[model samples]
Target: MFLDASGSAPMTNRTLEAFQAGLADGWADPTRLHTESRRARQLLDASREAFAEALGSRPEHTHLAHSPHAALERVIAGIFTARRGRDRIVASAVERDATLHAATHVAAGHVSSVPVDPRGHVDLEALARELAVPDVALAAIQHANHEIGTVQRLADVAALTVAAQVPLLVDATASIGHGPSPAHWDALVANPADWGGPAGLGIVALRPQTRWLPAWPEGDDWAPGGVLVPAVLAAAVALQERREQLDATSLRLHRMVGRVRDAAAAWPGVDVVGDPDERLPHVVTFSCLYVDGEALLTRLDREGIAVGSGSACTTSTLEPSRVLAAVGALSHGNVRLGLHPGVTDADIDRLLALMPRVISDLRAEAGAPEVA
Candidate 1:
């Protein structure tokens, strides 16, 4: 009954098998020149190629990283260094802390945060104006929001950046596996875990023409100590498998998400967030009045259902969600549903059937009046 399938997913049996095989065959250091090393290198190379195919890019443009957060930090810093003459970075208000922190570090607090509308879509005119500013290095935007699942107008944003002669770095962590390949990005970061692969590995790719300098020391610039061969292989296999089932899985999950939204919206004082039509197929979020987020989360857990609360990245505390605040949505009693492909219709029905009681009971405990 686990429903919080956002940031990570359970690896499939086939992917696990590939990982086990990689452990045996790819244990050697890929940088070495010995027989075992060459075998490991072959596996690593093949994995890179397969992953590139998934991204619609070439192997030469792709590199493996320890994790998605690390990849994001590295990519932003690298591009900022290459465009040293340009000191300012433009990014959306709803970007992950990882992106914002890296941008701040490189730009020395010269980052401009663009606003998003109530639907979580970035303000294109504001973004265009910011990009048009002088000394602008690069702009970072996620292909889709990790929390509310709002898909940005990426092509429009890309056009703005291109016109301003600024490089575009896209955080594709949420959309890579669940949607179509991004057609316009100079640099990109993706999470293998988002596609039911190994969370230990990350995929970072740069367009050949992107003016990105190496952020790390020489020798192992992209990956400081190289990457985990088995993990990379497992990630590649998982992405390929997900791609094969993408069309059908996306449609099924979208319908399920719509059902969840409909059920949740029926509750009084409930505010369902995100664009109803232009959002990711597997994610939906809602905020309930007269309830504490942590209390709601704990109650759901007791009911044998698991879901995310508050910010997708900063769920450690029940602090209000930045994404919700940006969209002018209710921030309390938040529940984010990231529908895993394995979740069946019965699971959704059970969740929907119990939600009303849960909300009402929590409200009673808080002594809050019904909002009608």
Candidate 2:
């Protein structure tokens, strides 16, 4: 079987087991006065504790949301509203779409995008310069990129923001369970799916004493509304399991990704994106000159190999990946691979053996320059 780790992996058995166990307990509003409701509240509280411990934060500080996007949006809006003073929002140019949209939605400020190096890393010096301005209210950067997998110097960025007395919101969706939580940031957001948990839940942990005003009217202390108890419990259990597997899983996936990088280097006209040595262990991206990324993705899928194309977000849109464009990486013929613990050695070998042929076919179809 081919490796399909590019955001296509299903939830692990451990997570499913946890979900089933939770299902047997019963369903009740966690805030209710009944015994079952109190039990539900206990479960939610326990889940919060588990997630908080994994992220190196206090349980009460963590906020559960319906999705990573929701968490990010809530956190950004809360920060922007609460810390309003300046009319500028500073963010890395390569931030995820949800963040970009949130920043754009707030018409009160001008958005300042910090440029990244060609290797897909934020220039800390540039960030420092921007943060130096007293008018910058909030700054956002990812702990690691989702597409190219390049890990950023979050601590350095956080320090600069702290020096500027600005709140730094980090999207750790791609890094959370694979490595240490970026506790240095003012606000942190991550998805459980990235750590082999169910897709519906996202965790946002805010620093204690961080003041946040909700963007919408709310009766509860949850970021926007009350938390999803079952999803939260499932996410916590899944995160714990993913953390337990991190050391070994990272080593194995790193080796596999290294092989992919080496193979891509040998292929003519193929350029790997991101800082190869400084990127996350489970993901890598590359571009094949002159071939269309969508076509390549289709060909791979036909051959039972599933991977991600950086060319488009949704199937309806054909725009190239903004993340790749921000770093000056090739926008065409792009492929992104994200590995998880469920992927096996055989799966990697299958993908490796099939890639060369797929590239050759794609090149022929596109009438591209020879791989020289």
Candidate 3:
């Protein structure tokens, strides 16, 4: 299930076939003048167009990068280049590490952070106040948080940034295909993995008249003429297919997540995170006091339930989730269940039935107080 849609659903046969074809086509350099190169170019263009259509933007405005991280770096560099006087950057306290790090790296002035509510929504008034500063150059906020699943008021934040004349960059990695459209930001970056596309690809969309510069010096080594052909095509096709299934899939998963949240509420010491009504439909996180998240994740893996832990970014340090910490949510034994097409009603029911017992046993083993 983890190999599939973040353990939510399985990939369609069509998507798999497309990926296979792309791989089988082999390593002909896309920039060369051979017939194979032209074919690769065509594939890349089609993919860009598909991705642009999915995001309600023009293909010319989209830049295909090796990863979402790369795309974000480009956007940040662009904002800094375009802005004249301001050297400061503002971001939400709960931003993805990649975004926060990039903002901090490029910022020549103070970097301000807008705090989140206990439920994880951005403080809009605080954001406005930060943006009001004359030296603020850019403001960034995520569409939906990765760990807690809280969706931000993007349109409201975008309007605030616009009023301040500061460019807004939105990281839509968690909510691109499954949530509301991101037509508000000056720039947006979303990963294909969130929408069932293969990894190694991300879509970056720039609003009309938005000027951006690349972080690295102009060289072919970086983007190879700023084009990632095959991966871009695959991502675009995957996004298109995912968009087609989004409405119905979202409704189905909403019901499933609702059941999980309801059952989790009955578990002692379990504190479900995020606003029940205003979060992404497919994700729900809960904290089980006194139990370690890594241990809970391992036990669930043994039970054939592939879920994510909030304790660490696996790729980086083995620390507690920064996202949860920012929102003041429970930090211990937190697990996030991200539903994909592969997860069914029965799967959710099984998890709901087993989770309470699992938490109870773990708490007992840890000698923690019983959940009221």
Per-model CA lDDT versus the true structure: 0.88, 0.81, 0.78
User: Which 10 consecutive residues of model 3 have the lowest summed lDDT?
Assistant: 1-10
Two-way TM-score contest, 2 vs 3, winner = 2
Q: Single out the weakest 10-residue window by summed lDDT for candidate 1.
A: 311-320
Native-vs-model 3 lDDT? 0.78
Name every residue pair that clashes in candidate 2: none
What tens digits encode model 3's per-residue C-alpha lDDT throughout 1-372?
451244223456777777767665624567779988777777877887887887777888877777778777777877786786788889999998888888888894478989999889999999999988799878889888877778888889988988898888888888887866777888888888677777766678888877666557763133545454545556666678778888898899888888888888777777888889988888888888888787788788898888887765332576778888887878878888888866778787787778878888788888888668
Which model scores highest in lDDT?
1
Clashes of each: 0, 0, 10
lDDT of 1: 0.88
